[model samples]
Target: MMNGHFDTDNPDKVIHKGEYENSFDNMREIALAPNTHKFVLNFWTEDLKIELERIRTLDITDNLTKIKYVCNVRPYYYFQFSDPDGNIIEVTGKYTPKEGQFV
Candidate 1:
């Protein structure tokens, strides 16, 4: 789980807290136009090769999608997918041993 608040006027914010069973931050963020729920997805994988494989085999509809797995890099492996509209979404995940490890 990752949660935080941003400057209402700013276009970005920081990651304050993240928790998972493993040492990874498997979080997904979606961005879209105002007054709309349709958006795009930003995602990262532990291994691009492995993540790609999982992506190919998973069923990611608008309602049944979640973080597939952890990404491979420090910031994490990145991929962008879109909704019906042209909104932008970002998904990222990482593995840390404890609370202060991911940073």
Candidate 2:
């Protein structure tokens, strides 16, 4: 189960425990850039801020630097970091999708 949503028999659909919002499952995998994949872990703005600050205080390798960027069309704030496996992990929040926006 993920985020209170359970995997359904339909590979493309996850059954949420309550009212569903803008969630989707793409059944097919697409080619990603070298050392990168489209796997993002989102968090609330406050939570992300706290977590990022905590990470900065850790005496970890310098490779785990944080990079911030914004998506103008949908308007979200996020930071990206590469894991040991080279998969891109994004800690994101503050999504301001326009009405009728298809995420």
lDDT of 1: 0.35
lDDT, model 2, position 70:
36
**Global lDDT for candidate 2?**
0.41
Highest lDDT, which number?
2
Expressed as tens digits, the lDDT of each residue in 61-95 for candidate 1 is 24222333332222342333344453445445453
Give the worst 10-residue stretch by lDDT in candidate 1. Answer: 21-30
TM-score of 2: 0.42
Clashes of each: 14, 0
Per-residue lDDT over 1-103 for candidate 2, one digit per residue giving the tens place of the 0 to 100 score: 1221223333244322212222222212212233224455544565555566666677442444342433223344455454566554456654443453313
